[model samples]
Structure formats: C-alpha cells, structure tokens
Target: MDRDKEYRDACNQWLADCMLIYHNQVEKIRKKRLAAATEALTLCIKKQKKCVNETIKETIDFDTSYANKPSSVQMNVPKKVLEDLSFHSYIRMSATQLENLVSLTGPEMQKNNCFKKSIGVAQGLLLTLKFLAAGDSIYTVSCQYSIDCETIENIISTACKAIWNQLVLNVMPSDLSKNRWLKMAQEFEEKWDFPHCIGAIDAVHIVMQPSSNESPSKQKSNERNSIVLLAICDANFIFTFVDMGTYGCNGEIFRASQIGCAFENNDMNLPKPSPLNENDTENFPYVLVGDEAFPLKTYLLRPYPQKDCIEVSRLNFNCRLIRAQKTIETCLGILSSRWQIFSKTINMDVDKTMKIVQACVCLHNWLRLSDLSGNSCVRYMTTELVDQKVGDVFVAGSCRKSSERSGAFKDISCVGSNVGSRKAIQIRDSYLHYFNSNETLTRG
Candidate 1:
C-alpha cells in the first residue's frame, strides 16, 4: 500500500512539470505574434502619414498660386497644333533607362557628382551609341551635340571602360572549363563539318597615321602603312584573344608562327595542345582554319591548290570553311563599320589605339548579348558577306601541300592543265549570283 501511494505521487509531479513547459511555449509564441502585428501597424501608420503630408503640401501650394493670379486678365493667342516631337525619335532609350544601365556598372560612375550633373547618364549613353551606330567621327559628334571635342572624347573613353570592365568581361561567356570548350567544338563540327574547331583565327590591318618618330626601316611602302591586329574569334564573332603589337606588312605566315610559338610557350593563357588520340584520323591536334597566309601544318587547314581538283570539290571545301571562318571576318567588319575610329587612320598612340580596339570589341560582345539589333535581315547580310569572303580566300590557294608543290607544278606544266579550274568557276559564278541578287531576297 505504501509503494502504490509513492508511485501515484511521482506521476502527479511529472504531469505538473509538463503543463508548466507547455504554458511557457504558448507565452513565447503569443509575444512573437504581438510584436509582428505591432511592427506592421506602425509601418502602415507611417505610410498614411506621408501620404497625408504630401496631399496637404500640394493643396497649400495650389491655394497660394491661385491667390496671386489675376482673375479677369485675358489675352488672345494663336492656336498651334503641337505634333509629337521627332527630335527624340532617334533615341532608342530614355534618360531613365540609360541611367539605370549605367548605374548597373557600379557606384564609381554614379559617385562622380560633377560628371552626373554635367551630362545626364542618358545623354552620355546616347552620345556613345550614336558614335557606334552611325560610325561618326568624334569631331562630327561634338558638332552635332554642341559639346567640346575633349569633353566628348573623355566621356566616350570613361563610359566605354566602365561598360567593358563591368558589363562585358563580367557577363561574357567564359571558356574556362574543358567541357564547355568541347561542347563548342562539337557545335562547330556539327554546323560546318569543321572538326575540333574552338574558334576561327585571322588578321586585320588597322590603318594608323604615320608615326613621326618611326625610322625608315620601320615603315612600310608609301602606298600602304598600318599596324596589324591578329585575333581569334569564337562562334559568336566575339574575340577570344587578340594580339595588336605587330607592324603592318608582316607576312601572315610569320604572324601565325609567332602566335603558335606563343601558344607553345604559354605566353598567353591559351589552351595547351593535346597529343592526338590513337583513333584520330588527322594527326593535327588543336587546329585553326585560315587562308593561304598560314602554313600547311597539322594544326591548320588551307585550301587545295587551284590546279588539282574538280571545281565541285574546291567549291565544297571553300563553302564549308567560309561558313566556319565567317565569325572572325564579321568581327573585323563590325569593328571597322561601327567604330569610325578604326575606319580612318587612327592618330592615337599605339597603346591607346589598342585599348580603344579592345573597348570596341567588348562593346560589340555586350551589344550582341543584349540582342539590340532591331533589323534581323540587315544583321544577317552583314554576317553572311563576311563569311563568303573568308570562304573565297580559303578556297583559292591557302591549303596547298608543301610536298606536292614540286611534282604537281612539273605535271601541270607538262599537261598544260587549267589550275583549280573546276572550283574557281563555280565560286565565281556563285559570287556573281549573290552580287546580282536583290538585297531583300538575299537577306531572306
């Protein structure tokens, strides 16, 4: 009887403790809910007060203005139909939208109070875009906007650098992973039947004013003098790598060798060439397609000699390469066509010129990402013509085998066979057909 009584007493004590814990938890929850409700009510009251204050201020201002006005005064004025102003028609962006984009770069551009006050972000962006879209010189742009030349230049340079560093580099598709590069290679192969192509390689001559300090030996002939820009572009016509220090008139072969050496030496952070797989048909590893300017290496493919094959085979190869190489050519065309700075002889120092080129390329990539081109047909034509030119150049004589040269030349002389006769005619006819076609139809 005594043991039973003790057990009952312990059970009662346990029940009492459980009730106490539950009561504490309920109290905590209630307090939390009450605090949240108070915060929400306070915010609502604040907002209501602000609205009321604004309404009272507006009412007072209106009353004061009405009290100062003369009630009986009237004057006859000529009626005018004010049509919507077209002055802003060419401006594709509003001041607010441009300011938003510029603000996206970061606080550095926004913090410059003098800059912000002098030129609104919208006006600055419109000026730069006008320079790009219309290919106008800085002088011309300055005249149109009634801005000083130095001010215009400074604005363009600052804005371009900001856009390049923040928007272009930060947002560009990276080629860091091998998996992504391999996927790109596969896409190139599928589209153009060009195997293992990560990108297209080419060179362009950027005309520059004669350097006053250049020695006689450094200058090219009087007819042509400029700096050469060697570049590699990806499928989207975006430059993956660029080399701009070479002088004009350097042989394409020499430039290719330099670039190859740079890759071999790890001078640039280029992907290292891998050994060929056992099953690989072409022993060439890490290849780039180029015109005759490049040598006949395992890593590069040029066109067959003009005399060797039927026209159909040459035409086919040319067409394929043209489609592949179009990216680089289009890159150059866009650079020259959109940026008038490159269209004429650039007078800036070499370092500044290179920076401008890089800035332009970065801008092009950014614009492409934004899909800002309104007219699809015009864009297509611009890209297509560039590809066709690359194809024609590659098909003509770029890919001749070194071993076959001596023997083939002897045989061609003896046989008196027409060189590259088959493919040349087809390409010529196709080019003419393209040239003669209506622009609208061609774009379609």
Candidate 2:
C-alpha cells in the first residue's frame, strides 16, 4: 500500500511541470503577436501624418500671402510713392514714364502658358529696373520680389530683351536724316564752338570675367577679360553711335578702326564736306574729334601728340580738341553715375551682359529725352562743367596776352608737319587760322 502512494505522488508532480511549461509558451506567442500589431499601427500613423502635411502645404496660397504682405512690391509701393524722388532714384524714371514702359512692355512679358502662375509684366519690369538702378544681385532681387531665384533670373533677362527689342529703334535712330545731322553740327558749333564738328568720340572699358571654357591660347597676357564700349556723343551728351564687345587687349586706335568701317564704306551717311566758316572758300569735312589715341582721318580729327608738339598752334589745337572731347567723357561719366551698374563689374555671362549694356544705352537716351521734355527737374548730369573749370585755368595761363597769341600763329607753319597728309595739314592750318582770327569768340 505505501509503494502505490509514492508512484501516485511522482505522476502528480510530472503533470504539474507540463502544465507550467505550456503556460510559458502561450505567453511568448502573445508577446510576439502584440509587437507585430504595434509595428503595423506605427507605420499607418506615419503615412497619415505625411499625407496631412502635404495637403496643408498644397492649400497654402503663396501669391495671396505675397499680395497681402506689406513688404511686397504690389501693395507696399503706393501710387504717391511712384512720384517721389526717392522712388525715381530707385527705378531711374518718373511715375508717368514708368507707367508708359510698363504699358509698352507688359503685353510681351505677360505669360499665356499653362504654368498660369507667373510674374506679371509690370512686376518683371520693376524687378529689372531695381537690378539696374541698385546694381543688386539676382538672389537679392528674388528675395525682395518674393519670387524664386530661377523666376527672377528669367524675369530680368526677358524684360531686358523686351526693352531692347521694343524701344531701341525709337531711341537709337541708326539712319539719321541729313537735317538731323545738320542740327547736331549746329549744336556742336553753338555749344562747344568747334566748327563742322558733329560729335566727340571715345571709348570706355566694361570689366567682366572670362568664361571657364575659354581656350588657353585665346586668353590675353594681362588676363583681363573686358568689353570695350566705343561711343560717339554729341554736345548735349547724346550717344550718336555705339560699338561694343571688342577685346580690351585691342588699343583704342584699333577699336576705332573697327567702328570706322561704316564711315569708310559710306554707310554712315556722314554729312558732306563744307566750309568751316560761312565766308571761307576752303571746305572742311564734318569731323568727330578724339584724343591722340585716334589716327587723324579726313572725317576724324585727333589732337597732335604733346610729345611732338613744340609750337603754341599745336597746343591750341589740342586745347580745342580737348574741349570737344569733354562731351564724350562727360557722357560716359554721367552714364556710370546714373546707372551705377557700370561702376562695378557685371556678373552676367558674356552674351547676357552685352544685351543688358545695350538696353542701358537705350534707356539713357529715353531718360535724356524725358529730361528735355519737362518730365524731371534733374537734367542729365555731365562733367562738362568740370571741363569748363579746367578751360578757365587754361585760358588764365595760355590766352592772357596778344604776344602769346601772336607767337602761337607764328609757329603754325610747323604744326601737323610730321603726322598728317598735306591736305589734312592744310585743313588743320585753315582751322588754326580761323581760331586765331576769331580770338574774341568764347573758347568753350
């Protein structure tokens, strides 16, 4: 009976151990199942959060926000602000003129494409003007205009091309009429007192960076990559002709040679040779005065180099040439001061920079015309007044006495002897005699 009791106890213990192992296995399975469910739920939650964020971003109206913001150009710029001098200083145009430009350029700049959301014509022009007047970077303008960098770049380039295509013909009349040339000549004689002088010729350097792809052989020794702006300005500081994009390595004389082809080919329609004085029988060609950098042509007059010039007559010719050449110097000075873009190096690629420069020249003419039309009180400023001051100093030193004047004419025989042709020398001597005879005339 005792043996039977021990066997029964052992069996009971074995059954209890099996039951405990089963419970532990069930717990392990439950934990694994719970962990898988939790991971699935977490992924769903993340997907829902991403979807909600995207929907919110899509619903936000960038244009509407920009319009309502006081920092924006549309709402921030008031109607009265357009007339203010500060506003004009920023855009370089009066309210009326700006309106006209917007009206003129608006249709072309406006987008009709499917992108439906694009910068407007007026806004684009405003952006371009801001860039030109302030010399601001594209990124800066993009931030101010509330546009993307790509959009700002597109707007500026398109607006500049539009301005050039639309208004350049009207502003820069290439085929000027004979009457117009005569009027220019008359103005030169009246203002600068240089007879038969149509304009003053000069050149300025516009600095730029060479392209990365530029061949090593093409690179200049000085490594200066620049565009030469060869221009001729009338007495009133109007650019009559402009040729740009010549390499800076080429000297001014070589650059002038490039522009003189039109005149040589008779395509320029330069005025016919006429007498310097009304009573004089000897005829003189309508001439463009330049510095010693230019070679003396029948139509182009350069000063006798001071190194070779010993006589007072040569000095007098040089003084007169300097007086006329001041117009171009002053024209370029005013251009740089007003635009301010030219004062610093242009950061654009070569092709775009060329277009912008051409546009600036056109706009300069437009503003000058506006100034003459009673639109703005500020006249197109020039350095001619400073030139006049220098002339005052020169007259005080050189033209004070009759003996000094007599001594100048006495040496006239030696003038232009080494430099110019006989005919050219004779023409210069006639002018020298004319200048000497009219000693009472204003030496402007």
Q: List the residue pairs that clash in candidate 2.
A: none
**Candidate 2 per-residue lDDT over residues 1-444, each given as its tens digit:** 899899999999999999999999999999999999999977874453342432232221112312222222331222224324666777777666777786676666654221125554555576688788777877777667567777666667777877887787888777788788889999998888888888898765566646567776554532245566678888887788887766533443342445667765777777788877668787788888877666566667777767967987677777887888878766766666566566566766667777778878888888888766767654544333233446447422111121121210111111111355677667676676677665524453
Runs in model 2 deviating more than 4 A are: 1-83, 111-117, 212-224, 248-258, 377-422, 438-444
lDDT of 1 by residue, 1-444 (tens): 999999999999999999999999999999999999999977974453343432322211111211222322121111111121221223223223334455564344444442354454434655665664455677887677666777777666666666666665454543345665666566666655565667787665555556678767655642234445667776666666666555423443233345656653545443444423344342234456555454444444445555753666455565666667766666666555445455455654555556566667666665454443552212312333242346447432221221122210111111111233444444333433332336413332
- Supply candidate 1's per-residue lDDT for 136: 67
Deviating ranges (above 4 Å) for candidate 1: 1-101, 106-122, 171-175, 210-225, 252-261, 266-284, 305-319, 338-341, 372-444
TM-score of 2: 0.70
TM-score of candidate 1 relative to the true fold? 0.53
User: Each model's RMSD to truth, in Å?
Assistant: 23.2, 14.9
lDDT of 2: 0.65
Candidate whose TM-score is highest: 2
